[model samples]
Structure formats: structure tokens, C-alpha cells
Target: MGLRRLAATGVAVAMGGALVCGCGPLGADGASGSSASADAAARALIAEASLSFRYVGDSHVDETMNQQLEIKNATRGSVAPVLAFTALDKNHQEMPQVAVTTVYGSDRGGLVVPYGTSWDTLRFSGPGEHDVADVRVTVRSAAAARIPAGMHDVKTQALDSQGHEISRFERFSAVRLTNEDDFPVSVRIAYILWDQPPKGTTQQAVEVTSVGGLTEVPAHGTSVVQVSADAAAAVARNSNGPAVSIKAYNSQ
Candidate 1:
């Protein structure tokens, strides 16, 4: 199935008859069927141009509350949202030393899907005695938007044969320069060879091949170029190179 822009997102919590009304009911097993289904329900509310959430399900790990929240980005553009879980004490007041764990399905903080691609699992650390009073999810433009107003930067996640997502720790990856402004922009990418840089100093890596001169990332859209296997191998040779760099041209 394709993606759909949301118009409204909701939360419904139910634990063996104890219910907190909204969205779909949480099954007795505390598993909400599938993240994709929950994400679709939350995406129904995306046209509101705000950050919304749907409480899919909840579980207890070592007495800690683990909430499965579907964060819906209802804006026209991408949103980077920060989520926090607030626990209330016996006195109905806030508590300290609270820890919130976020496991993302998208690029690790690269850019939240403009309309939410999947659900984010949030594990709130500490005892459930301090009931969770609130789950705050706030948004801002993705880091790519802060790139000097004309340029855009993004990190790519490599996937293995099994389609398992890979991170920078595993190996070199690719980048896509997008044009999200009102005006048009030109974009290109290249691979840099940094096979073992000298320690303790900043030095430019040797420039390899560049894929440039033609690709234009249209306004309000994006263009993608895969990193050649040679590029990955080159970066693998280096103990420090991040692999490839993105270039943009004719940027307004």
C-alpha cells in the first residue's frame, strides 16, 4: 500500500477493562496488532499541521512503562519531533530521574516522515507507581532545513540483503540532497577516499568520482543517487571516512 496524509490522530488505552478512551482499543495482550495499522489510524489526523499521537499499546518491563506511540506529523513538510514521558508521583506531582527511550524506524533522527511512516516505541524508565500523566511530542523543522537556507543534508541508512536497516557503524552509506524551498536548486553527490587519516588533525579526504552536472532536485521535491559499491569499499578501507559527501548546485 502507498502512503496517506493524516487528518486526525488519537489515543485509546485499555487494560483488561480499565479504559482511557480514544482511537482503537489496546488488546488484552498489550500488543496493538501491527505498527503499520496503528500508524495508518494516526495518519488520519495529519492535515492539522501539528504533531499528534496515538497510544497503540503499553507493556511493563521490569515494572517500567513501555508505550508504543505512533507520532503523526500532520504538516506539509517534514517534522522532527521530540517525545517525553512525564510520570506523576503519589502526591500527583512530577518526579525526577525519569528516562524515556525512543526507538525510531526512520533514519536515526535524520527526518521524521512528513506524515509519519511508522510507530515509535517509547520505553519510559522507572516504576509505574508514578503513573504517566503525560506524553509530550513537540516538533520542529528537520536538521536538513537548517542547512544555510539553500542547501540540504541528509544521512542514509544502508540495508542488508535481508532488508535489515544498517547504520554508519556498519559501513559507508549514501546521501540525497533535496530541494524543499519555493525556488529550484541543483544537487549532486560524490565519494571521498579517506583510507586511514592521520590522527589528531583535520585534513580533507582525497576526492574520488563525483556524480554531478545534470541532476536537479526540483523545488519541493527530492532526487536520489545510490553510492556505488566502489565508494563503500573505499570508505571501508579508511578507519575514519564517513564515505560520501553531497553537493548542490544552482540552489536559490
Candidate 2:
């Protein structure tokens, strides 16, 4: 059976209105200004409707293949909505990546969630029409034991109640290794970002708690990688913060 396309859903009921503001910071003492800034940075990144993903698939699993779908806004007046990919492993663990694209379809494009937006589906826009930009399927296993040589079924749908096909790209397999077994193996994540600061800004660094550990890839295995829509915002805020720096957990 074909996998069901899950619709993206929304979070807020009202737009542009500041509801109840939380009380003073919690804990033994109020949060420091820097800590508040850091929290704000994290919250900003998290609030964006962007998506994120490991370039080479889940680090916790021993899979050798994965897939990714991305969309960007190409016009003004329209905000780029966040794109999300929820991977349901056979084991039932839910893996989610949230961030924006490194590359926007146009200069005016940046992640946007007009009030009353839903996260149940992928939405795209342009001056007049909408479309999907890229669809990538990765083979991240040892080259020797590459995915079975045959046509693998592939399909992509907007995670909206009203299924939409923004755009479709060619499907092909490429080889790469995740090195999930702790052995040394070379892996690379190639992606574009929207409104990425000049390289110099990225040079400014910060420290962040390790959210998860890297998985060791076996000598002959592969893993897939993809970026989340909200990742761009998170990366931008974290790296561009005044004092502390934030790094994408797996942005190597």
C-alpha cells in the first residue's frame, strides 16, 4: 500500500495578537539577559515554520537510504512557510527536523508563518503560482552493497488535507556513507540556504548543548541527509547572536 500523505497542521489560533505573556523567568533566580537572549534565539528558531533534517538520515538507525523534499517561496508579499518531514521508523520512533531552507527561491523569500497557518501540509507560493523545487533520494550505504539494483517506488505529496503537487523532480540514487559504527568514513552534506549571512558571520561561533551523539557508520554502509525549513532561522539566530553562538547539532 502507498504511504499516506500527512497534512501539515497549524499551531496558533490568532495572528498578530500577543496573547498572555509568561510571567518572570522561572527557577532559583530570574534568567540572565544573555540567557534570555539565548532562549529568545532558540524560541525564534523554533517558532519559525521551517524544517530540518540530518543530511544523511537518522543517526540512531542503521539504514542506508533516505529521502527529502524541499520548497521555497519565489515572490514578495508571501512568506516562505516551514517545511517538515516526519520519518516513522519501523520501530515507531518519530524523528523531526525543523528549519528553513538555506536558499530561498528569491531574495525576498524567508520563512514566514502568517497568523492562522497550519503545519499539517507543505505550502508554496510565487507571484501567481506554487511549485516544488527539489526532490532528493539518498543512498547512504557502502558502495559495495548499494540499494538493491531495481526501481524503488517513490512518491511525494504536500502534507495538506487538499493534496497538492507543487512540483516534481527526477529521482535517482547516489552513494554515500554515514559511518554510523564509529569507524572513520567521509560524509558530506550539500544544501542551499535562504538569506544566509556572509561566510564571515558564520565564522562567529557559539556553544550549544549536544542534543544527540553521532552514529557510527559501518565500513560499508550509507545514510541520507536533508535540511529542515526552520533550520535556517535557527542557524541564523544562533550564529548571529550578540554573545553566545549556536550551532546546528549535526551541521558538519
TM-score of 2: 0.17
Please name the candidate that would achieve the greatest TM-score relative to the true structure.
1
Residue-wise lDDT of candidate 1 within 46-97, one digit each (tens)? Answer: 3223555655333322221134465555455554333344433334355455
lDDT, residue 196, model 2: 21
What are the per-model C-alpha RMSD values against the true structure? 18.1, 22.6
Please provide TM-scores, in order, for all candidate models, with all chains considered together. Answer: 0.31, 0.17
Q: Name the runs in model 1 displaced over 4 angstroms.
A: 1-49, 59-66, 88-97, 105-111, 129-134, 138-252
lDDT of 2: 0.23
